[model samples]
Target: MPTIWLFAIVLVTGLAGFALARGRAVASAGGDTRVMHSRPLYHGLNGLLTAMLPALGLLVAWLILQPVLLDRAVVGAIPPEVLEDGAARSLVMADVRRVADGLDAAIAAGVATPEGLAALTAEDDVRGLLGQAGVALGSDVSPYVLEAARDMRATAATLRVVMWVAVLAVLAIGLGVALKRSHADYRARNFVERGVLVLLVAAASIAVLTTVGIVASMLFETVNFFSQYPASSFFFSTNWDPSFSGRGGGSELGIVPLLWGTLYISFIALLVAVPVGLLAAIYLSEFASKRMRSVAKPVIEVLAGIPTIVYGLFALITVGPLLRDAIASPLGLGNSASSVMTAGLVMGIMLIPFVSSLSDDIINAVPQAMRDGSFGLGATHAETIRQVILPAALPGIVGAVLLAASRAIGETMIVVLGAGAAAKLSLNPFEAMTTVTVKIVSQLTGDTDFASPETLVAFALGLTLFVITLGLNVLALYIVRTYREQYE
Candidate 1:
């Protein structure tokens, strides 16, 4: 909370600084001057950018680098024996911190000893020797725990005081400057507008940075996975029994069965969602009256707003049993609620609004001019819509469908409840089958061994799903871009 308050202060200070710089710049020009390319506001925004950019960058760098430096200093204080024994870095670090903490408590309680006191010794021999080693091999133990703590706290507090003072100082200064210049020729509005523009751009860039970070992290993990498991086994092996094998403990990695089940359920879901959703979109966008559209569009989209857990329960209690009795049992099939069809059907119902709402928007985007042109040629309303508008809007419709397919492939709850936990490859949708998402949830939702194949397999599955969705998104983008050319 203090950090947040500090940030707010810095932001306000920067904005005010910008506003002042802008007013000064504007005022320096002759009172009758109207020669600048942009409004005075742009100048103010530019000033804000200058003040805030370097300051914010410095703050972020300090936050990231401080922890690493402190950790290194803490690690250096451990005895040579602990360091030389080749223990895992994490375990060693944990022990060092524990020992240091013990010493601090002992020192406070006046119960220190050389053996027990070995952990928190500020002895010159230890400090000097560590410093020499660190200089020789970059492994110094700067005995500055107390000093570092004091400096860090003091520096943070100083920064806070500076931030608040700066904010109030700049705002008061900027307002004074602006008010002094507030004749009929003053340009306060221009300065404010420029500030708004810069803020919007900053907001947009955050989302872009986040997306890049996610993709980069996922890509690095996938590269590690491929190095461990052969691409052939991951992509083509039909079996997924990655049991603990031997003393060496490397389990086989296969993804084909998971992929098969994923595709099968998504296929069933699309088969149900496409016709129902597209028809609904067409009716809502083209056929429905204004009153019907206002009432029904929100109502249809409301299904999408329903939580997936609720849908999962519905699948488990209602749809799963109904399918078992009405369809599967009568067909001489196994009577399991947790079948591929049960999940797919329920998922399709959940996806109806996702498809329909998007399709409606794209369909509505079709120019009324095209409809008028068709009607002028004596085409009926149904034929005009079916033959002219739908084709014209096909790219957007296809994009919507692709997005829906990605959603279906990635869905977890419905499959968890209505698709059985069996990982068998099967042709019959009525037979139980598990999906990649379900398996990932099952594998990670408990006391998982990070080194175990069962747990690590989730990462591999995640990489696969990420790649597949990426491809679908790319394809959707391509279709949308291409279709935009048709109208042009």
Candidate 2:
């Protein structure tokens, strides 16, 4: 059976078990209002958990493991010479999966029964037959590979049958146990709560686990990159250049220029976003009428809903040109339309709502009594806001700003379109420059050789970006924790 079908069966069984267990528990208490150890709802939930968790867990494991096991078995059956001399292993495995799927298609289309399909030789127009059944191979299938596909299909079919049996058996056993444990003194509520707590903890840990996994994968590939390229050249050199596969190997691959561009653009973005967003937030929270707040706040936040690509286009077609003509050119700076200022301004515009909306909510969340206390001390409105309200909201405002800074730092589309892909260490914001992210994309683009430092360098760049963002978050956390006030 298909996985979805198995899920439906499990769900239906669990629901049925719930009803049965709820009825059983009620009957055991003689339908008394207070005699049972737990409510009918808790008893039913206990039954549902019992029938679902073990069966679903097993099904999940089976789904993950079966493909891996089958692939290993089929790969072991293939001759090593084919992978060594013929083609890449990934291509060969892909062919194996495609052919297996073709055989199943042939069976479905009545080109051959499963028995006849197994008995057929690879020499007997296998490709044409599979084609007739709507699976086209790039080339002729070898006898061993054809046989391996057949074995894979056969083994997968058997495993599906086994998974079906095992999942159902577990479900049945669980329901039976729940039925047996449905007495008044069974403590069904406690069992149910414990199971719920375990599930909640698992859900909560997923983010941490995912972060660790991401860091580990990048670190491994980064280690691979560093093995081929010197760490000193990558970190200390000011250049950012990578040689093509045919151009021979003396690529500079320096990170300094890219890091400078990244920080420079981010600094400009923060400069634009922070004061504007914070002031807008303050106005909305402190000065706006209720009607204006409802309308204007959403209007301001609409910038957040606008796509970054759209902002990139705006930077390219509008903002970039405007800045070059109005400011850069008139000031005797470089007249390039695509410049650090162009991207930074556009990115800052994109990030405004991120800061403004968050800061607005945080400022509004400050206790009303704080403002009243300031007023009672004979402080003016502006003075009270500066001294009392802002300080009280400082931690949350810091968090909001940090969020905006992170967004600015990671921006890609605006940087790409507004700031031309010129990696350079320049003091002029009017000069075009590219960031680490843009280079990461460029290095990994097209048919890249994984063994080459050029491709592996993307992972290193990514790891560096991750570390930078992590440090920012840590710094923000330290600032917030250190300065946060305790309110009664």
Give lDDT for model 2.
Answer: 0.89
lDDT scores in order: 0.71, 0.89
Q: Model 2, 148-243: lDDT tens per residue?
A: 898899889889999999999999999999888987777999999999999999999999999999999999999978887899999999998788
For model 1, name the residue pairs that clash: 41-190, 41-191, 134-139, 134-140
What are the clash counts of all predictions, listed in order? 4, 0
- With candidate 2 superimposed using the best TM-score fit, by how many Å does residue 300's alpha carbon deviate from the native? 0.7
C-alpha TM-scores of all predictions: 0.71, 0.86
Error of 1 at 353 (Å): 0.7
Q: What is the lDDT of candidate 1?
A: 0.71
